[model samples]
Target: MVVFKKFNLDKQSIEVPGTRVQGATGHYRHASYVNGLVEHIAEAPHIKTLYDLFQNSVTKYGDREFLGHRPYNTVAQTYSGYTWQTYAQINQRVNAFGSGLMHLNEVILQNPQLNRWSLGIWALGRPEWYISEMSCNFFNLVSVALYDTLGPDAVEYIVGHAEIPVIVCSGNHVSTLLQNASQMPGLRAIISMDSLQDTVPVPGATSPAKILRAWGEEKGIKVFDFDEIENFGAEFPRKHLPPLEDEVASLCYTSGTTGQPKGAMLTHKNFVATVATNREGLSIYLPLAHIYGRVVDTNATFSGCKIGYFRGDVALLMEDIQELRPTFFPTVPRLLNRIYAKIVASTIEAPGLVGALSRHAVATKLANLEAGKGVHHPLWDRLLFNKIKMALGGRVEVLLTGSAPIAKEVLNFMRIAFCCVVTEGYGATEGMATATVTLSDEYIPGHVGCPRAGCEIKLVDVPEMNYLVTDKPYPRGEIHIRGATVFKGYFKDEKNTRDTVDSEGWLASGDIGFVDNRGCFTIIDRKKNIFKLAQGEYIAPEKIENILMARCNLIQQIYVDGNSLESTLVTVVVPEPETFLPFANAITGSQVGLGDNVGLAKLCRNPQVNAAFLKELDKAGQAGGLRGFEFVKRMHLTTDAFTVENGMMTPTFKVRRPQVSAHFREQVQAMYADIHASTPAAKL
Candidate 1:
């Protein structure tokens, strides 16, 4: 029952992947599976809950490094390298933290919500974050995650609705909690990860300690440092209250602008059954508020793997990775795309016969990638791509990316360049990070591989989009997921839960994709964020944008917005520095590069450059098979990248259309106005 094929790297070769599930289809119509219904491939049958998983790991691997983080020096205002905590140390703290929450102030023991008190964790991925989350599982309390970047308004809604009486948060988040503390009637206490004397104030922001003292006093809510709670719990110990398999372990709130956030209820069984599976220290970076991050951490902990946190600085992220030397690298496409661009740009700048050799090596490796070799070339890997491989720690054996669709070319480029298993996963928050990840053995470029173990995927027809199961080439429809991996329901959201997961338990994924001949799914369109033009052509901007990105590396991120009353479309693009800067300098006869923000910002709005860039976009779109109506009629170029902080992008790097539209409303209107004045100029 070995799920993975054993390999001997000494032989200079790795085992093939996903071979056990080749050509596997499911019982349901258009359904797909990695290994079908034959036991889900999860070997840890005894691990029924996160509580059990941790206990087992602690018993077996007590001396092993459980979690590690870089200590930020307040005096020097810089971070040192990683400091680790052993499994035994972490286990002791987990007990103390859970004990305090349950025994003191009757936190979970008398929640008044069936003794199922909900604790809120609002922070990035850190030791304290993971500890508090695990404490909830150990004590049978529900851990509710507030999106790391959510403002006071959304946090207020989630806090009030979930009736979270106590919130464990990072120092920076204390100010946000204080903003609406009075509105949260059920809230009784706040636990800050940093000490009041030590909480450093961010630029232009009030001190967290001051807000805590002021607001906590005014609201009659108790405030305690994270260490205080742990010490208190140790002093007044309580017995562990492990959860039942069916009990909800977490209340994860979904982020969107459509309506109030709906909490996705994930049970111990739902999670334990799926995870029970990872690597051998994960270089963690994704937010723990996300299911992807949480589950990855869960899997890593279960396997007794060390987890390292980034130094909380995006600028020095690569430096942290270089120091950590992680064997497994898990990240989102946005980050990987940046890394890919840097490598490609470096190859382009190599002056001499070296440049020609690099180009030839790229072509040869790409050909090898298409043939299912998968990041392996006896000659090229060690000789040509060793430096690129070393960039991600010199020991990265696995590379996984998810959250949004990655450019096909980028996917292939990464596979060849990283010299590792480069995979892309597809899933959503509601799915409990439910996914279909590409197999390392699969040579396919655009497809997210077949259904993962413990889950099943099917396609339901969307008539308006002209997608149906009966269509040829492949069946096209809305993606539906069902199985142990999917969330049971949304907390207290019966209507939404019912709407999302029908009687059959198939969770309607709102996304559109088609099952390929290999039983893989290539995400094509989304049901939401779709609009019809005045002449009546439905356009999936994401599909169009993905096409543009695959064909044109110059375009970093693109947003195509159109008025239903208008006959044409317009776009705002964030271009890659390496690709766009050279193009810009060539056309404008001016030299501008990264770090010259003022010059780059001004060049982004140059009319001549914008006009020329539009034609370049046209050529790319045409190459990707875009029709005349689908072509972008006008475009605005931007040096500014959309981000979660700007409210223009999601954590997963997908642009929030509503936010993007609002931010660019004036620019969008101006583009439309110009298009209207040049009515005769519109063409493919």
Candidate 2:
């Protein structure tokens, strides 16, 4: 076993080869697309400023789709929105709002107490963009986006943090904000884009439009409709530009990765560069609301591909896909799995007894895949895969998954079922849009693939920083990225900004990963979660955790620990309620949600479930995949999954290690307690 004197990593052997060439080949010409991309970048104004990119987009694809939205759940009932040519008009309306704000500034001059400029947005997707763009362009105001899913406390926290002066939300998002609107002292006017006449009968129900009118009358503030100003811009030619690249466009709060969400001041340049790098095809099932979706929208527009927007329940994903027939899909693993599950469920639901036969047929196809017979699904395709395809709008050429790790089984099933590739991409809000698995090239299931064109992927070794450093062959360490895609820095967070972006401009990804021999990068895990056992062997919990997540559906959350004490590697697992409920053979459903944790844990320890878990663990450990030292020796199931509300998971859904450890501290102690109690008997 390797023992380390320091906590930080000293050396790593993973690296991206300087160039992919024959052993003796000197050089080769750049690919044609590479040349075209470079030319595009060059002929493109230095974009020394972020506004330049917007101007360029407007100039080149003025009539193209910029931002769009539609009704939630309805497929054919979609809408294509105004382009950048109209974006100028949109800006003018925003400027008019700013002009109204300028009027409000005069009123503020009299009051002298009002100094903060904060704006809030609540519209589901497209309207959020309009308000955000307007806020950034007109007043240089900082806008805080509240996640519609959050409760009053989350909304209150953002309002308190940003000290917002103006709250702009659509009908859908305003009601929630109103729950805590009175708490925000600086909140002056609430503007509603959605007609709220019907909702006004309820206690917290009034249109922001009506609210704004009443508030403006009381405070001598002026209000304007977005549509009115939009019309005015078209009638009158208005040409005014905002600040340069250095100017902050939006204050994007972190996904609350830590305890509380810290606002990252993303400049226009940062967002533009991110958007530029993220330009890709838009297929069915992606909304322009997310950062990923926004990037896809820009990329599709530049690439001259039309994007179809769906604003409905993701539950109707099949209907949307079947109706839209999009060629590209950017999604997370969960959605894809659900689609596959739907396929499986649908197959089993059809033809009564024959549903069982159809399922067996699908299984036989997967078995054939393992035997290297190579993707021949005759009966399943006719009976099963076709429905899945039609449900997805039938023309998906590729599916892109990212954000979290995905199970290989899920990836393989989708690829085989859809006859399309499922590739993965990796990046952070800080990295903007640095690395991605390209669609035009080869596909690797687990690896995040190579750096996008023109990206410099280097692993920095900092043994003193608790990060592994290696330069043996393919250098492995912290993934340091320098590319057009990296963000400028965190908003007003000097220490974090300094820590994140090095003097040389390499952005520390915080994620620990390595490039394999093929130049394909695989994320091992988070650096902070990497721990060493008492025996001096370091273990990455994520690798083991990912395996467990894939192989054991019964385990919802797994935390591997053997760092400080070591009789054997141990884990705290949370049971999947749906999977474990059947095993309990419950007494007429005894109050489940919270009350079932103890029962669930005991069931996990039951002979059948324990054997299943151990068998899978051994199979995974011996799969020639994980290092021997990293194998799990002992494990215990927990009651619940780590969640954001409980402070165990980040908003982005990544585990909070410290929080998880704290929550499971007692359980961990008990595991060791039982182990020590049983030690004497084991010795005999």
Candidate 3:
């Protein structure tokens, strides 16, 4: 059993029934219950690898539905049907697929010239994607996940760098790969998940097999349908599955914020450890290409929880939620913020007594929650909170949000509104999706709870930025993590890997945060993102950006940029349409109609409107307790929301700073030039 460090909740720690307490010495690094679970997992002899976990789950729940997906026509926007596979059924497919892959490997090994072979998958949340991934695991072939949103260039770079021999992809991805096939010399075969005729067909097209045959002949690469491989495997009985130890399992590429993306090498042991520390029951909506989604899927599968996939369209997520009524929902801050904004808007704008009662209920519930009282009042629970719960499918027991820091108000509102435990975790691609997760009972606003089980965390002082562990009340510094869940290293990048993971086996997170009395961590800023201004004050743009977007209703999205040469900050703002339109109309004394892109663009550049927006920024800054240098001094408002297609946001929804900066290069230059020309900055 692992002996965990202890922390004192108070000088005299008292244990309540059904609640575990950290030690009285105030030294425990992990939650008590989490430590118990980790120790239990460590002691279990059968749970050694991810495959082992899956086998165990199959043994326990063979007849239960393991995976589910909604089938719909993309163009028609009509639901065709729904499909589910039981654990036993899925096991049969995985075994057959694994055997087929082994057969393919045998063929490759017979060649004298070939030394390495791997497979890639680029598709959405479909059964084929899951089967392919599992088959790779069973056959000991390295699985490379290709994001569906990746452009042709990025896809080529990743495919060539990884030297992928076979690719199983959807129709759109097939077209992308075909465009750059000449650039990828290592690619051998292409398997279409959908019918080739439906995916890529000529007018008066022939059969899918013939079309694929013709295309394959032209490209000099073999092409097959998804069913062909399965059928090939079905000719033989399932092969004996073996447990894998520390072998490299998957190569998940990082979202390239600096330059080209690097593949992170995640081993089977790393995944087993991560899943061992996880709780069950999560509705997986995040793309599987992301580490966050992968961890959730693995954990849910291992824990024998029924996993549900959303319809391809994200706009229809609520519909899926209502249909599935999942017990837990894993989400990111972006979606939660939008939900909060919409609910607040609807409540305030509701007509007559209905709106008044809604407002009163929210206010009462919030007040009670702050005072450490029950969240549900009998009257309010029926009239307001119950309806709110129904909207979230009515069965949500816990809501987990991560990938970014949510506003404290939004966090608190979610807890009260849903009357469920809302947890916020901190993780990165390097850490296998989680380092710290908030406990159910410990719902501090901005703090991601204690270090996870089997993970040891320590802070190193960065005096240059004035962060120190010896600070009063709370100790602050750069967080370094050491754990089994950390990735092995960056694939084939020894120098970068050495720089990331130190000689002491500690991975420098590059994130600066502080620990409070309860051993909870509150992230302040990122070390790389911190910039010093000409006036000698350091500014963390992400910290300020979160504050602004969380507090200001008119601001939908923002990118705060500053340089060492400039004393003040500048921002590119994507305004909230509903909020900005009304505000703009009041200023112009004329109704600005909705969907008027040209008029909105002109309004964004108007001097009077800009001045008012500056005041709004000042108000938001004051509300967030921001420093003087943290306030936005100049701004450019755009009607366009940053999206993945525009190269402004990552697939995981993180703002791409360099890309956004480059796209708005002219506006940024003009903002700086105005300041240099002695044009007074917007009055804050």
The list of candidate 3 runs beyond 4 A from truth reads 1-28, 31-43, 73-77, 108-116, 197-204, 207-209, 236-243, 279-292, 349-351, 530-684
Model 3 Cα lDDT, one tens digit per residue, 1-684:
111223433211111244312211122346454333252254345676667777887897799777877777878987754467888999889887767655554553242333225688998777778888887766667889897444456678888888887898986667566657899877777878876544435677576667656766687676766776776688754555554767788899864534577888888878887865553212233212111277877876765667777766677776777777767788776567656766766674488987898888888888887776745688888877777787677877778887667778888889988888788888777878777877665434777876776566777787867787777787778887767778889988998899889886778888888877667788886778765554334466888899899889999899998874455799999988789989987897767788888888888888889989989999999998776667888989988789999999989999988789889999998998887566422210
User: What would the per-residue lDDT of candidate 2 be over residues 1-684, giving only the tens digit for each residue?
Assistant: 111111111111123334422211111111212332211233344654444554554566555444444443336665433222244444345555555544444343343533336566755555445545554454455556666434455567777777666666665555444545556656655555654343355687775567755655555333444444334444543344456666766666664423455676666566555544443222233222222354554444333344454554565445545555666777765466556555655565467777887768767866766564545477777776766666556666667776666656666677667755556777766665446453333333566765554345666554644444444454456677766566667755688889888897777777767665555667765556654443334466776788767866566677877542343576777777886566444533434444566666667667566556666677866663555666676667656767899998889999878778787778777776765456432100
Off by over 4 Å in 2: 1-43, 46-68, 71-118, 138-144, 149-154, 175-179, 196-239, 275-292, 304-307, 347-386, 461-475, 529-684
For each candidate, what is the lDDT? 0.74, 0.55, 0.72
Alpha-carbon deviation at 614 in model 2, angstroms:
24
- Top candidate on lDDT is 1
Error of 1 at 592 (Å): 35
In terms of lDDT, the poorest run of 10 residues in model 2 is: 1-10
RMSD of each: 13.0, 14.0, 12.5
CA displacement after TM-score superposition, residue 383 of candidate 3 (Å): 0.8
Report how far residue 537 has shifted in candidate 3, in Å: 27
What digit string (tens of lDDT, one per residue) describes model 1 on residues 621-661? 88986767788999989876899999898889778887898
* Model 1: colliding residue pairs: none
